[model samples]
Target: MMTRVVVIGAGPAGLVAAIRLAEGGARVALLNKGTGGLQLGQGTLDILGYGPDRVERPLDALAGFAEAHPGHPYGVLPADLVARSANYLRDLVGPALLVGDAASNLQLPTAVGAVRPTALASPSMTAGACVDGARFVIVGLRQLKDFYPELVVGNLVRTDLPGGGRLQARAAMLDLPAREGEIDSTGLTYARALDDPAYRKRFAQAVKAVVEPGETVGLPAVLGLDDHNAWSEVAEAIGAPVFEIPLPPPSVPGMRLNRALTARAKAAGVRVVPGSKVTGFRASGGAVDSVQLATAGGDRDFVADAFVLATGGFESGALTADSYHNVHESVFDLPLRRPEGHLVHGDYWGDPQPLFTIGVEVDEQMLVRHPGGDPVYTNLYAAGGILAGATRWQEKSGEGIAVASAVRAADSILAAAATATDQGAAS
Candidate 1:
């Protein structure tokens, strides 16, 4: 009999876990409330962004991170597993990203022209890498709101280059081909326009006219919606290397990953249930027997051999706080580890913010546990931001934690299934 697993939350962690379990010969179902963090992120994998400062060799620096913060997800999880998960992501979302040279972080620029640390990025986004002999032309569309060419130019000119060389920077505005009397336009709107091959040709010409010879051109992440090769085709037509700079929240680059991964999951025979709100579960003995998801018709019950709670932290509303500010882990009602006394809520850079790390307490096998240290359910596990102890935004370790913890949970369930089969055969 195949091992059955239900993974809640459709973010990178949940998606990865579902795919991994199915690949491991398990029947899997991925349930989610809504489109997840990928829409809000750059869609690039950030392993460990700032280890106080930017990390060059991510794999090597993790050793120090583990030593410093023993209870942190990375600290407790095996380093080899983390590395393996990264490779899994790289392989799963092929062509949507350009993973940096092994063992090192991909230093890529953001929308603001300031570079940040990431593990892998699409080739278009990777063009922001400050390579030798690379001069930059930052182009902003006048139609595009929330994008300032001058501000981007100012930051790019003054910002530190990764390769430690002086390069010239210039800014230009592209009057992107658009219909007249258009009320408002967003990145997605612009991307749809570019999807028309004729419009894209005209758009590429406008960019080509402005770009100087041998200068790599940078633009907002609105390239194409249906076509993944829009940026590359434009680059080839314009005779310059064009790359995308990830914009503000509801990031386009992130959307690309979400679409690709969801498509892949469905193709792999994984049933993906969207808008699924997990209200509760039924437990028997020491394991979860069934999960309940609320619906307009009524509550639906799903029985599985193993379960994974990848419902993200507060930002995703998987974890909520009451009027008295007492935090609650909404699903499974698992015990959360938070500061006992007054939490440091100040906006200071180095202050220990208690709110960020309040999440489900889990044991080494990725199984949920009580505050006093007993497993809440042997078959129930957790992965991603819902597992406590690391401030992901500051550390830039969100993807790393999600992928690593997910792989951990999947492996644990597979091992448990194998053991059960062996015992049953002997009996």
Candidate 2:
């Protein structure tokens, strides 16, 4: 009999979980709200801290992990799988999706009108250049998003480049609006403009004009350089090396990757049901029995021997805690670990504390822990950004963490199921 697994959310964490589960021979169904964080589109993967010094290129770190964990879901069965996935993604969008060690040495054009060496996604890139002093200009889209040029500048200043030289930064706005021509002050609205070639051209030109002749411009990560040709063309025309930076969490690129993963999962025979909300779950003796889903078609019950929760942080709207400090597992009322505080720290970059304390706490096997520190459901597993301890932002290990957790969770799930079947047969 095939094991049926239902996964919540379609974000990177969710999609990756679904993919691994399905590949493990389970009938997997991925559910999402259709628009949970996909539009940000800053296409850089941050797998920070690997290799001898706990410092290596992002791609190299991922590649090394894939090589070491060949049987892992994120790991490629063959050595070329890593390159193949990278190449396929590069082909889909544009050539800017750089792979290999060379990326560290690659000179990138910046909005500031200067060029700089690209930084690995893991270790945070310090703002100032070691060589000639450079001016940094941050390009803001007039009506786009939550991106605050001043705030980014402040962060860069705070981080202080490796050298003592001061990194100067200024902000300029691009007058782009959302779908209906209405300007959204949040600035997140300009993300949609990337799909338009004309918009890209105009934005690139505007950025070029603002950059001081000798200075480097640090544009928001959404410059629409989705391909290599476009990246090069924009680089040549702008006459500045462009360094793509990772946007904040719930980022557009993170969302887009999730959507892509969902489509791929569906094509691979995984059932994807978006807009289906799970309201409650039925569990007995610490094991999930079934889940109640609220959909447009009405209430539907899904029974599965195993369940995977990918519903992300407080934003994804999956796990909610009550005033009494009781965390309710959205689907099954599964016991969850509640943090003492809503946030580990008030400041975004204040402390590099683990994010897991705020999320559902799980054991090493990726199984959610109950309030009493007991495994709630042996068959129920959680993975991705939802897992505790992973600070996607400060750690720069978002994608790698998500992929690695998914692989680990899938392995555990399969192993548990096999053990169950063996016990049943003996009985």
Q: What TM-score goes with each of the models?
A: 0.96, 0.67
User: For candidate 2, lDDT tens digit of each residue in 264-334?
Assistant: 68776789877768877888876888888888778788888888887776556566656655555565555
Q: What lDDT does each candidate get?
A: 0.83, 0.56
Q: Which candidate has the highest lDDT of all?
A: 1
Model 1 lDDT on a 0 to 1 scale: 0.83
lDDT per residue (tens digit) for residues 348-374 in model 1: 866668777778877778998885499
Clashes of each: 1, 33
Best by TM-score: 1
